[model samples]
Target: MRPFDPRLVRELPQTRAPVAALGLLGAAAGVAAIGQAFAIAWLVTALVGGGSLWAPAVTVATILAVRGILSATTEVTATWAGARVAGVLRERILGRWSRATADDRPAPERMLTISTHGASSVEPYVARYLPALVAAAVVPPLAIVTLLVVDWSSALIVVATVPLLPVFAALIGRHTQEATQRRWATQTRLAGHFLDVMRGLPTLVSYGRAEKQADQVAAVGDRHRIATVRTLKIAFLSSAALELLATISVAIVAVWTGMRLAWGNLDLQVALTAILLAPEAYWPIRRVGQEFHAAADGAEAIDALLADVPPACFAGRESMSVRDLSYRYPGANVDVLQGISYAVRPGLTVVTGPSGCGKTTLLELLAGLRTPTAGAAEVPRTHLVTQTPFVLPATVADNLALGTGASPAQIAAACAATGLDRVIAGLPDGTATLLGDNGFGLSAGQRARLGLTRAMLSDAAVVLLDEPTAHLDPASARQVRSVIRDLARTRPVVAVTHDPELAALADAQWPLTERVPA
Candidate 1:
């Protein structure tokens, strides 16, 4: 795993399109604003010089209408672009999650924060702040240059005070980033603790510790609330301070402009334009500061998730081999098995062991779910079947296909191999039977058999089974073992089981027991 950084949060499909559109929109908006300023100056001159007002009035109306249309178009485009970026980001996150290890899965609360609050927090910034930021950069400079041509003093005032907004924004941004990071950490912790407590509710109740656990949850919630309030306070203060600075700067520029007008150093039209445009210069900086705070939380969560993604290991030889392989759980002092070696030729081998003797762990090692802590293990291609099968919410045929795009006939053959053909025939929809929510409607045995069928459908060189028959009745268990035996005749099968009958049927068997290391 490498350190997480925001740069790695895959680029969105709409990134380039939105950026280009925003640039064009900003240019158009700047032009429109300058035209509006020029129109205002002309209208003022027309009224004062005792000329016809109708021309200036019509010009003002035209500029306003054009500006309005451009603004609306920019807004709509920004909204669509932001939504598309968000969708891309979500898909990338889920894709990375699927490739991550079991241990890499964030605590339930952290997952919720990322999926819900973190995602929502970034929306406005992407859609509104980004495009507005581009416009601000362009419009302010053009407006200030127009003022400079009319009166240098007003332009100087606007220029000198404008930099203060960004300076203040930088300082505030630093503080906000720190505060947001802390707030995000606390939020994830609170969520994780709540989920952990909920998951252990039965145990807590059994031991008469439910009240104690409730107090702990309350304490965690209180801490999270405090952190949230602190973050909000900092965010609000930063926004207010930036707004005040911009406002004061604009006011000072306006007052200076008014004095120049009174002294006849500048005309009324130029003074009015400068005053109207002063705030526009600082608007973008202030908006960016506000949006930075909103995006900070999501960035922090993404950082945490990305930091744990494991680096890809080199795929060497095509076939897998095992030599004196062993593993131990993290922080454990002893290996579960000692100096175990095996070669899985293209056929069935069953591993029989007592409870807590590392049968499932062995299957995981063979399936590439975990690497050996000592020695080496090799696998060409493999699929695994656990006691509790995971059934995705899809058609029965899809479940068997396992995203491999296997044909209907192939799926049927796999199902038949696992003795599920009769089960499918009995269903009203046959292969199209909907497996809802982890296959809840199906019995445990049915789910297990379906899982076995899916593994068969995978067409891997090796199939690893971890107690595939544990949930079945005697008749069904025997039938499944017979099917497995038949399949093993063609390709290698490595099964971990406690069933003596299954072990006896294996061409070769390995019994795992606690023993001294070699």
Candidate 2:
């Protein structure tokens, strides 16, 4: 991996200013540090030569104070940069998923890991490693130039030794990067498995397979643990090796300067300054090496988050039309749908099929939530209500107004149309009532109505629903069916359902059959 990715600034322009600020601060700090070294050397020389010490003392004190303030500011800037970059990347990642077709996204669990854990890992990379990298770039060269001005022999020694740190760091970093990648993959797998177990816990328990799932989770956890330890081991070893190399390089410079001073070839002040500045040339590089290990996981996450995800393809048309549309899943050998043709019209169109006849997939395609493998679909702006509509934790009014920008009056009207207004009225806070995660405390019918109400608020030209009336009682089903029929009167409505009553209410019916072998 590169020490720093330029794409970070290109992809997230908001971070550019903060990153530039960091570079400036790092440069300023380097200047201050070098000044402190010179000031200390002057103070030592003044005391030894019986010269006035007040000026040198004050210079040392002032430079040290400036360095302290710069240190604090660097911390603050690094923190802000970390948060800003991580948050922006997370938002972009989620926004990409929101607009992409189903096939273009990663698995649910993998996406969950990326948006949360993966993006979060970038914080340390931005906060600590970046500043260290800047320091390594700005400080060492400045120190070497100063050394060259004072004593060319010392400067040559530093220049000769400085290259060794990065070369050794690169060799160790190769193994470190590999170890970190393995650990990251193992971590992703563990996170995916744990999420799967949680989602399927109820089913697993019912089938007496919960213990098996527990064992599987434990096994994955163990593998992740081992990978983590191995990565950390490499990180620790690399840090030690870099530190040892830096110490040895600095010691060599110090030894040469000491011999020059003893032989009366180098002045005492020059020797002291050389001793001080030699470490400056090596420590920043060491810091970068240490920070790189801490930021390795973040580097991997950045690569994944920036990977290309194809956008959904939908052509604008006057009306929705499917012409010989066919789709086969990514890895499937046979098509779930083939040679399907239809043009949606201004009425309810019920699509009926067996359990595995791609009925749900058909609605997804029409809604531009999936791309067809063969042929084309001309889809207009659409609102798709899946079998279990998404309901995040929020106020009733907020959930209803999500993405629609509907006013209070408009939201009330949409709720009334779907009979959700009654449900809202019975709540303690009415529209302001806060719902739990996944619309907890609301029944299936109520959640369904909430989804339909949202659809009612939308200005979509087409409405697609999956299993709208499934798992509802007779009274709730009647209310839902009435709302759906009322919606159909205004624009085109397509629903995938097994309900005979809903199918009977359709103005047209499209029945699908299982695909026969070619």
Candidate 3:
């Protein structure tokens, strides 16, 4: 990982102010610390000489108070900035995912881990590491410079030994970065597995595989525990090594100063100030090493977040068309689809195929959800209604109003068109009633109609539906098909289905067959 990535400032201009503020705070704190060190040295010299103590004691107290205030302000600023940066990163990751093509995005599970846990992990890096880094940069040089003027011998010892801290840190940091990456990868997989298990819990229980899933979760959790312990062990060992080195270096300086003072060659005030300034130069560098190891996971996350992401784009053509389109899964050698071509205009075009024949894949390609391996798909902005469309645990009106931002009248009209108006009228609060997660209160058929209702309200140039009539009863199927017909009147409508009745309503039909390897 870089000490500080310039991309952080280049891509996220909002973070620049926070980072600048942190730098300023760190510099101020460093100045205060150096002043306090001198003040304490003066007070000690006065007491040892039997001189008046009141003036030097008051000066030390005032400097200490200033140092305390600086410390508190740095923490407050770091915390607020850290939270804001993490929030912005999450927003950026999720926002980019929303506009990215299916092929351009990671799987749902990986995306979940990165956008949630991974984004949150960056907080420590911003809050602790950055401030520590600024301190290391600002304080060590200031302390060394002060020592240079007062006692060049102590300054030489400090300058020589301070380099060792970073050298040791770098050696340890290489290992730490590798360990952190492994731990983070394991964390991502563990999170993904848990998320998958939770999402499929009902299915597992129904199939009597819940016990097996529980065992798998336990195995993964154990692995994660082991990985975490290993990472922490490395961090602790490295921290201890740094502490020992700094302590020994300071001891050497103290020994040298004591020898000179015993011979009556060194003055009391100079000897005391040299002792005070020695630790100042070492502690900030050591703290930087400590915070660096601690924030390794966050460093990895920043790399992932700032990686280049290409946005999904669709052609601005009036009609959706595909020419010799072909596609394959990421690892598979054989193509899922090949040598296919079709056009969708302002009328209903139905796609028919048997199971595993790439019907849904074709629609996804046309909607810019997936990129084709060969040929091109020239399509306009499209709204795709997948099987089991997304529903939130929110007011029915709010869910319907998603994406389209339809007015109340438009929503009512769309609901009436899809036969959802009757369902809403029977509810306690009608459109204002809250539904359960993933439409718990609604039947499969109602949910299907709800998706179609969204499509009806959408103003997208093309509408793609996957099995729109699959979950509906005969009456509901007919009603939904009528709405589909009406929608096709204004824009291109493509539906993937086996319903012969719905297929009969199509103006044109395209049949697909599974492609076999040559």
TM-score of each: 0.87, 0.98, 0.96
lDDT of 1 by residue, 48-99 (tens): 8999999999999999999999989988887786676556556666666655
Model 2 TM-score relative to the real fold: 0.98
TM-score of 1: 0.87
- Report the error of model 2 at residue 212, Å: 3.4
Task: Compose the digit string of candidate 2's lDDT tens values, residues 325-413.
Answer: 99999998899999999988889999998999999999999988888999999988889998888997999988998989989899888
Question: Considering TM-score, where higher is better, how would the candidates rank from best to worst?
Answer: 2, 3, 1
Question: For every candidate structure, what is the RMSD over all alpha carbons to the true structure, in angstroms?
Answer: 3.7, 1.3, 1.7
The best candidate in terms of TM-score: 2
The lDDT of each candidate is 0.76, 0.90, 0.89
lDDT of 2 at 124: 94
Residues 232-264 of candidate 3 have per-residue lDDT tens digits of 999899999999999999999999999999999
Q: How many angstroms is residue 221 displaced in model 3 relative to the true structure, after the best TM-score fit?
A: 0.8
Say which prediction, candidate 1 or candidate 3, comes out ahead on TM-score.
3
lDDT of 2: 0.90
The local lDDT score (0 to 100) that residue 8 gets in candidate 3 is 79
Give the total clashing residue pairs for model 2: 0
